[model samples]
Target: MERGNRIIYNQDGKIILQTGETTGDVSGHDTITELHYLDVEYGSIDYNKQHIESINPITKELVLKDIPVILTDEQKRLKALEEELSMLKEENKNRDSEIVNTAFEVVNMKLNNNI
Candidate 1:
């Protein structure tokens, strides 16, 4: 009869498989004996808005404490360019609306004068 391997906990609460040394079934084991799975969902982090402040070893939870976003010079310049582009696009839209309104007013005036 073959004796199946049994799991045993060491004094440090580490799991050890009792496999005969002759069978060569024993391998290295992890020190973490108990790991509770968390059902929490983690969202994609925006480095500009959030930063990892610390991590809990036992729970393996990431602590995201809000702090001032650190950006490189190039990143700062790029952000400024994006803001400027948005403002310019808004101004262009307003100008186009104004031009359309002026054209309509001119057409109405011409119609009134002709009548």
Candidate 2:
């Protein structure tokens, strides 16, 4: 993944943090599953150990603003392709080894018949 991202904090940087092209791409505030979507996609996602909050002006209370955190369509598509290629490579290796083992078995059987 690229080093730089385009997300900005919402709610005076309070309610959510968003990036990419789509809405709520890197959501902050609450987390789900032992991980969140933001964790899966971004290199760094900062949150307080005790409490997580959004960014905003220091002096005043902030209201909710809608910002998007997104992974571009192209990026998502490329990631799928990479996964497919990796699986294909693993399958190819298995097939290649099968061929080699079969060939070795055939050679050994032929030698036994000759003996």
Candidate 3:
């Protein structure tokens, strides 16, 4: 019995799964069970970040792994600035709350003196 249609690899060993292009099949191709994408919260994995770590022989699934990236100097600086901006926003929110409370207290004092 045939398991399934095996994935076709080009001369460079890259998988050819194009939409319309047709390539003749040859022998010695692996039947890929599943193709996985990197699961991360911050950003979707791009081509540069995607690395094929290994393929499970039993499962016939290609494992996708994340490649560690070192941030450039400009990237590091931008990140620092973002963090500082977040902290400043929080500080402003707290100050606004304090100002409103002080204003309420002063108004209450004036009302009591008039009473």
Best of the candidates, TM-score: 3
Measured on C-alpha atoms, candidate 1 has an lDDT of 0.73
lDDT of 2 at 42: 46
Pitting candidate 1 against candidate 2, the one with the higher TM-score is 1
- Per-residue C-alpha lDDT of model 2 across residues 1-113, encoded as one tens digit per residue: 22334444444766354543434444433333342222222423332222224334454333334444577999899999999999999989989999999999999999999
Model 1 residue 55 CA deviation in Å: 6.6
lDDT of 1 at 100: 100
lDDT of 2: 0.57
Where in model 3 is the C-alpha error above 4 Å? 1-48, 97-115
Clashing pairs in 1: none
Q: List the pairs of residues colliding in candidate 3.
A: none
Could you list the CA RMSD of all candidates, in the order they appear?
Answer: 11.0, 15.5, 10.7
Best by lDDT: 1
Ranked candidates (lDDT, high to low): 1, 3, 2
**What lDDT is reached at residue 70 by model 2?**
71
Mind giving the per-residue lDDT tens digits that candidate 1 earns over 1-115? 3344556766798976565433344454446666444344556777668787767877789788776768999999999999999999998998999999999999999999994
Q: Which stretches of candidate 2 lie above 4 Å from their native place?
A: 1-51, 54-69, 99-115
Q: lDDT of each structure?
A: 0.73, 0.57, 0.72
Tell me the tens digit of each residue's lDDT in model 3 across 42-80.
544475888767767677665789878899999999999
